[model samples]
Target: MVFIYVLAAILLLIGLLLLDYALGKKHHLKNVRFLNFESTTGEYQIYTAGDPLFQDLFQDLRHAKKTIDMMFFIVKTDDISEELLEILKQKAEEGLQVRLLLDRVGSFRINSKIIKDLRESGVQFAFSETPKFPFFFYRLQRRNHRKITVIDGDIGYIGGFNVGREYLGKDAELGNWRDYHLRLLGDIVQHLQCTFFDDWYLATGHHDEEPFPTETEGEKWIEITATDGVQLEDVFESLICQAKDEIFIGTPYFIPSERLFKCLTDALDRGVNVKVIVPMKADHPLVKEAGLPYMMRLIEAGGEVYMFDRGFYHAKVVIIDQQLCDIGTANFDRRSLFLNKEVNTIIHNSRFVMDLRLAYLKDVQDSQPLKEHIFQLNTIRTKIKIGIARLFRPLL
Candidate 1:
């Protein structure tokens, strides 16, 4: 009994030490707001593809007086991308402290000349993480998927869009990929700046000491929430429990954790109208296969599911009860919920939710409904593929 007691005490001490370390990290992250957007003027803007949002962003980049920090999962060298690169280069030449970070994996296909030109023009660049054979497996999973842009420590941008021809409506093959982005001018911009700095530090081992804006004059209350591993796994469960009235969600992938699946089922039992839209043609075949079982379950619970027919439905958005909404790069799948460093914006604005609902309705109009009978009609080969996908979902 004494030996067991001693072991328990040692375990308690170790737990406390871990708790202290986690608390310290959380305190450091307090400089970055998790779920709030603020500015002095209460003027926040939402931008989408082909909406002249890039023009406003370019104007801000041209007028930046102090520093510019940007991080993206992918950066292509297409026309719109070239335009932004030129502006960034010009800003760097003007002596503004310019920093750009891109994921090595996502930007691997991009032309090397574009990166060389940016570097030659004095723009600082870093890759989020590079794989080194033996140590690559663990490092590759924790990717910097958040897209952030901060200018002069005051204005910021964060959302799902990447610097690519497809996103900018220039991909001749894809033809106007539908997406959403937000331009922030408030306290939340500082959080974005801090997020960039964290990635910058991780990439280059340098941290910025300047004070980022935490208070701004914006009216609409927006909160940015992020979770990875168990924390992320739990957040969706909490979101599911809090959902009331209606839940409208759209994602390119749809594999869900059991807890989340149960929460949605419970919400439906309580008379909540649950609607979900997923891509009819997913970019990842394994993910599409893994999502089939979940679709069948959701349909069993009277949840409405729509399969987008126009190209790939890459957007990740969720609107709860016409009051709380989330938009960002994180998809509703095991990979995003467990391994990737994902960011999402939660808005508590009715107007924003309404706008998102309208957009979702438009997407629904373009989608084909997945009737309950569709799952019943699947062939044996399809079932075998789903089984294989389920087995490999963690990697997918």
Candidate 2:
């Protein structure tokens, strides 16, 4: 009797949590606002590796004259993370206006001691997407996944790379951390700076609304899109539906929304060459399992899927017909697309898009082709995991 009662109570708790998630999502959609996707002229540099990217970023940090604003999904106390924090601290102590914002749950391991030290060092620090209120379960899962930094109101850094040793590929389990990031100059810098301040306003309730003058000189046309738990499906679906010849995608996660998946299939039916590159190794449980069915559907639709064997492929990018590309922190997954705050830059410059396309093809060369047979689910354990992944798809 006791065992049966305990099991029933456990099931009741799960049911209540599910109800909360459903209601919270409905509430989030009702209140979410979409940002305008207008193009901005800017100079850009893409970074595929961590070492050189950090080297360049650190150099810019040292040269920042007036102000520095930094934000990320995760910030650890590892070597590179420590170096970044120390740089921010030094700049703050030097009387430069500096602010650092991290995702509350993502940076929870940072501990009280580190927060105290950072405060003592004069760096203005705060946390974004902190859990609260009626929809506690859903709020806990909703995070701000954007990683962006602005310096002197002219320089901006944005993309998938978070501040950590693992991002530098120090983790023995996931070697050679493969990712994409961008450094920007010109009017786009001010755009990101404004976005940072907007998020800062949400986290700290201190409105710092000053738009610095930025000169636009570069030929590259870039558009930054900010999605607040809604509009991600529409954003990607719009892009996929517009592809004329090809669409190349690279992401660590592969779960796609239903309409987005349909748009890709429609593109494939139009005889567009669709190729996607994803990591073979599963960094998180159920993510791989969750995405497999979609991968199978993609295969059936004459699209191609490549499993990246080189390293943990953390790049979140989409190249459409070698004329447009979106490269940033938003992954091609439900959690990133539906539940989290994400920022992605869409480039309309043909030259840069072609360049990114060539690089993506090289990643495909280093990957293995995926066939429909892989989703056969031959083992019981695999089948069970996939079952759970399906049941918990919203949380994925």
Candidate 3:
């Protein structure tokens, strides 16, 4: 009789926990208030690895004259991060108006000593929506996953690379980190600066008093779509719906919501060639497991899936009909598509699209094509693991 009572109590506890989790997992895609698409001209430089990317960023930091704002999902305490901190400290001392906003959960392991030094040096910093109290438990499900940097209101960066040695392929565990980052110069950067200030005000409750650059017309068409958890899918669907030829997606996570899966299948039915690339060695096993089912469906629906084996493929990029390209921090997974505060750029330039296409072709060369039989080979235990992982995808 005691054992039965204890079992009943444990089951009740589990039920309540699931209910709490479900209540917090709200999909606000339809409610996302995307900033109006600003049409502008800009020069774009794509960075695939860490060395040149960091070099470009450091140069931008050094040359920044008026103000600097940075927001990232993760900022580690490694050499890369230390160097960036040092620059921020020096710039702040020089009166450059440096500010930083990081995600509390993403940078939880960052060293407090480094943070203290930064504050002592006059560098302003805050975490985006820090978890607190009863709200902390439920609010922890949401995250600000944008990676943005604006310097002098003239330059901007947005992509997957974070401030970490691992991102530079310096970690011993994860060999080489493959990712994509973009550098932009023009009036479009003002949009990035405005987005940064919007998030900064939300995090610190302080508005930026600095003046933004005046908008000017340029040579190429570019739109920066910034969205929170509520409207994450609007930009994606808007872009995908306009695809007339081919669609290429490269991301680390592949788990798709049913609605998005249906959209892709519909695209395939319309004779659009859809191809997806995902990391072979995932940082999260459960995330990888959750994606297998989606991969199978994509394969059966006349779409292609490629497993990137060169390294941990962390690039979130999409190319449509070789005419438009989107490069930013949002992945194809449900968390990135629906639950995180994400940012992406829709580049309407044929030259930029061609460059991304060349890179995608090179990546496909290093990847293995996934066939339908790959799913059939999974054992019962693996299938069960996938089912369990799917249940947790909402939280991931």
Candidate 4:
């Protein structure tokens, strides 16, 4: 009995040590300063108030000379999809190494003809592992929720935009979809490239031979950090906790982890003006149902919640203290926090943050306030549904 007790105590200590090490690494990366050019000079490219995201994406793809790598959760067969495919086919035909990674589950409805066409055009492709029962709980729970594209290892794009008509406001049922995507043209692009390569090799069992691009010394400095099951310290939660004065967050789904909820509540307690905007009508009813219970807590704690009435609010962004912004595909839910392989760009530029804030303001104008009365008025049946959703949120 004495030996067993000692062993248990030793195991507990080892677990604590590991947790400390993991959290320490996460904190270190969160605090790493990125050089913001706007701080030095009063000028920066803060593109807000409506920019043609697809046009920029097409231009970047058309200019790819050596390599084009892309990873996305979904790739619908739409106009944008066909245009992108044509550009990629042309690039591959020009001897450029083009690769695409799609999630098997998300793109399950995608026609096989499109895959055959791309493969016949010499574009290498692979599907992220599908969730299989009994033998693949890890793969089933953890998904590659990153939407990324890297061109020539110098230019990249990352954000919540998937390859779908709805994302570009081209779907009849999903009109005027609001989303965000960034065009990166510096050292951070390499980080995005590395992320794509890691996923590609994991899916296809082939690795790229090219050296990773080094950090480019530019006027603007940015760090791209990612989180997966491999690193389970909740990097996004840390960023939210670090917010001091204000936080403007927008996500389609807002079923937050406990750590993230505490962080936001603490920020509110510390007098941070916290505002969260979620879609009034989410594409997934389960996510919308799961998000309602948490709003009353946030509102009572001095935080504000709004539901976007403008079609679908699919973008995931957080502007912290009006100085730092994170834009990515990760939602504020258990899936993104603990299950999905998510990539978020930590931009320490005030200009970028301001731009994001402005966008949030516009989104707020288009949103309806989620008052305490709504929660009070829900019937018992609705409450039961919400309860079930909350119970299974981690799996959702």
Candidate 5:
């Protein structure tokens, strides 16, 4: 009788949580907003690893003249993060207008005491996309997955690198980390700053505006895109459907929506080269399995797939016809497409894209071609996991 009562209580609690999630998640995505897209020019340099990215970012923080603003999906508590915190603290003490916004659930491991310390040290810190009561369950999974830093008002850092040791390749399980980050110099920095402040306003109820950047000395045309989650598919679909010659995609996850999958298959049918690179080893359970069916279908359709064997391939990149490139925080997964707030920087053809192309080729060279036999479901357990992943694909 006691066991039955305990099970009943547990089930009741889950039902209440689900109800709360349904109510709270309705407004979660709508709450996050972005500035209007204004095309501009910027000089960009790509960083393929965290060591160089962080080293340059830290130095840039030290050199910042007026303000420092940052936002990230996750900020793991470790030595590397401590180093960054110390820098921000010291910079804050020096009277710089410093602000940090972290996704509440993504960085839940960061203790309240640390945040208090930052506040006391003059840093303005707040949690973004925090779930509220009555709808907490659904809202809790919604996230601000953008990673960006704007120094003073001239330099902008954007892409997948977050503040953590694992991002630095210190995790024993994931092995070396591979990603793409960009350091930008131009008016786009102002645009990034305005977007950061808009996110900050949503999180902290404070609002400020920065003017859009104008023409600069660079020849590269760029656009900063912020998505409230639902609109990303349209943007990506348009890009893919318009591809003339080839499509190159490198992402951590590959569970695309039905339309996206069809688009890729059609691209293959049109004889447009479509190549995708995914990590050989999955950092999360079932993610690799979830993509196996897609990979096999692509292979059946004459598409090429590469398994990045050198490390965890976390680069969220898409190159179309060597004329444009997208490098940002989004993955080729349903979660990114329909759930998380994302930011992507689009770069038009230039010498920069040519260099990025070379880097992409190098990454492909470091990977192994995905063979259908080696990856297709070979066991009941694997099939079961894939089945489970499919049921939760939207939340993956």
Candidate 6:
């Protein structure tokens, strides 16, 4: 009887999720917001792990005069995280409004002492969302995976590096964490701050009414786009459709939804060069297992898949045709594309595009191409295993 009841509950949960997806497809998919911002002119800089990423972040926090807002998927209690915490505490003590948010699931291991110290120092900090007993199944599954830091509403940073020692390549297993982050100085900073504020309001009942910096005359075009729940399908669709000549994507995970898989195959059919670079070894092995079939299908359709062997490739970047690019926290997976909240910066600058393209080329040199034998589905059991894993792509 207990087994029957468990099965019934699982079926009901799946049914409810399907119904929600159906309703969303009928309504929310059409009204998807395509965000874009054309700043008067802005300064942009891209950073890798060893390129003073944390130093630049601490400097921005120290220089924050009016307000500082930060959000990340994970924030550990390691040296890097503690240094950041101390800086934010110091800034808060200096009468500058400092706000920090972390995803409950991702930062569950954060030290309680740091939280207490932050609160004692007047740093407003909170977890994005916590799943309770009754709704634990659904609530805990959706995470806020965006990384954003806006200082004084004039400078901003966004990308994949979470606040942890491992992110700085201090981990024994994952040596030299390879990731990407961007520093922006322009009117678009307010938009990034607003994204942080939205999550802040959701996490805490208190809403911040501080005014963000106004737009100045700039030449760069940057759009800070974000999505939560079932609204990101169209945003990604638009991106794939916009790629005319070639598409270069770098992500840690590669579990594409069926629609996206079809779009990629279509892109390949149209003679567009589709190159995907994923980590050779995933931090979560199941992510690798779940994406195997899709990656095989992608390769079968004439698309190229490369695996980065130097270090853990955690950068989420998409360069479209050497003319446009996207950088942020969203991975090429069902969780990032459909379930979790993610943030990305869409840039329409030829110079920046070429810069990103050059980096992609360099990374490609360090990657090994996917061999045909590795993707051979010669056995029925192997096919069954892959199919089973693919079914759980959303949860992976």
Span of 10 residues, lowest total lDDT, candidate 2: 370-379
TM-score of each: 0.84, 0.97, 0.93, 0.83, 0.93, 0.88
User: Pick by TM-score: which candidate is best?
Assistant: 2
Q: Which TM-score value belongs to model 6?
A: 0.88
* Predicted candidate 4 versus true structure: per-residue lDDT over 199-243, tens digit per residue: 787789897765356333446657676766334335677777787
lDDT of 5 by residue, 28-134 (tens): 55564545788887888899999999999999999977788999999988998999988999999999999999999898988989999999999999999887765
For candidate 5, the 10 contiguous residues with the lowest summed lDDT are: 209-218
Evaluation by lDDT, superior candidate among 2 and 4: 2
Cα RMSDs, all models: 8.6, 1.5, 2.3, 8.5, 2.3, 3.4
Question: What is residue 72's positional error in candidate 3, in angstroms?
Answer: 1.0
Q: What does candidate 2 score on TM?
A: 0.97
Scored by lDDT, the top model is: 2
Off by over 4 Å in 5: 1-34, 211-217, 372-376
Candidate 1 Cα misplacement greater than 4 A, ranges: 1-42, 110-113, 214-216, 372-377
RMSD of 5: 2.3
* Local accuracy of candidate 2 as per-residue lDDT tens digits, 164-268: 888888888988889999999888777787788789989999987586776556667888988887877788988999999999999998999887898999999
Models sorted by lDDT, best on top? 2, 5, 3, 6, 1, 4
Count of backbone clashes for each model? 16, 0, 2, 0, 3, 5
Candidate number with the higher TM-score (3 or 4): 3
Off by over 4 Å in 2: 372-377
- Predicted candidate 3 versus true structure: per-residue lDDT over 1-396, tens digit per residue: 999999999999888766655555542333344656577778788999999999989998998898889999999877888899899999999988899899999988666787788888889988985766443445676788999999877788999999898898887766788899999888788888878888898888898765487343457888888877756576777677788888899989988778777878889999999999988787976888899889988998999999888878999998999999889999988887667888888899998899889999899989888783495548888788888998888765
Residue-level lDDT of model 1, residues 340-366, one tens digit each, is 677777777898789889989999999
